[model samples]
Target: MKNLFLCSSFFDVAGILPNFLERINSNCIQTVSFIDIASHVEEYKEYVEKAKLAFEQQSLKLEVIDFNQSSDDIVQQLQKNDLIYISGGNTFYLLQMLNEKKLTNVIVDLINYGKPYIGESAGSVLLSENIEYIKKMDNPQNAPNLKNYKSLNIIDFYPVPHFENQPFKNLVEQVISEYGESLPLIAFDNKQALWVLDKTIILKDET
Candidate 1:
């Protein structure tokens, strides 16, 4: 059976990450430590602590794995989780490392086994087939290196996060002209998101 998939522009502000965790029974969340890949060892402890505190504010418990120590160590560390939350960061680098460590299969298993998965920004982008279509405002080279690289493929369409933040009207049109309109483009503003649950997409607006 396929698990539920959740994609958000920004966890709490744009999506219901915090709220969703709070609403679940026990008011606690089961999260993996994928973002630790972006930090140094010295900073990871504090980072995880702060993340726990932030989630706990909304009654969630953020569990992290020191994937830096060994990316192969993620599977065991993730054994008890029911909900995996992927935080925001550099998508290209993250996917590169994940592939290097061969943790992508483990992540796919988590999703296929009825575990509810949540992703934000970079994390959300990895759920799609391609991240090359997104325009980088700061770095022109922010695009992922693998054009045919694999993603979790949890979402049916391609995603363009931070959509309304830029002049997407023209940029989107350009992409459509090149890639064809048959390609799905799900756009989200900083305060808006498109959520996927059981293969159904829902539009969520911030209050």
Candidate 2:
């Protein structure tokens, strides 16, 4: 069964993550393979630390992987982890690195094989059928090597993260305005997340 926890801002919802995992009977997670390739830039780098702190608070070990660096053992690293996390950053750049490293299929296969997956912000957006609609919120120029906007296509609907939240509020609105009629866009705020189990998708909030 496919399991996914897609979030707008993981830091905002970290406190309740364990509860959700417990509900899904996945609270035994001891280690996580954190894909930090998205937040590769200097400014976005801070998010990686925050993510590590979140996992540390849960007493879970983390093995962070950055595709920009030597990731020859990416498959082995991912297979050893109990959970997989993709951090938020430049969506285009993140996708570019995933494609460049040719780990997209590997990730998809792992998720399909029941490895729990968590995506925050750009990470959440990357699961959609196509990331072309996100150009309004994230700069496409950041991914100079990206040949296409095609994405993991893990989920059929488009996940609009940071909805009604600062900085990205207007950008998210723009995307919804442009693609709302055509694409199946699910917009959620920093306090909300999409819990996907196989074909069933549920939107949950802190409340």
Q: Could you tell me which 10 consecutive residues in candidate 2 have the lowest summed lDDT?
A: 64-73
Q: Which candidate is the best by lDDT?
A: 2
Candidate 2, position 123, lDDT: 94
Give the Å shift of residue 195 in candidate 2: 0.4
Clashing pairs in 2: none
What tens-digit string does per-residue lDDT give for candidate 2 at 1-207?
788999988877887788768867997899999988887753747767888998899899999785646556887888889999999988999999988888889889999988899999999999998999999988999899898999999999999999999988899899999999999999999999889989999888876
The numbered model that scores best in TM-score is: 2
Q: Whole-model Cα lDDT per candidate?
A: 0.57, 0.88
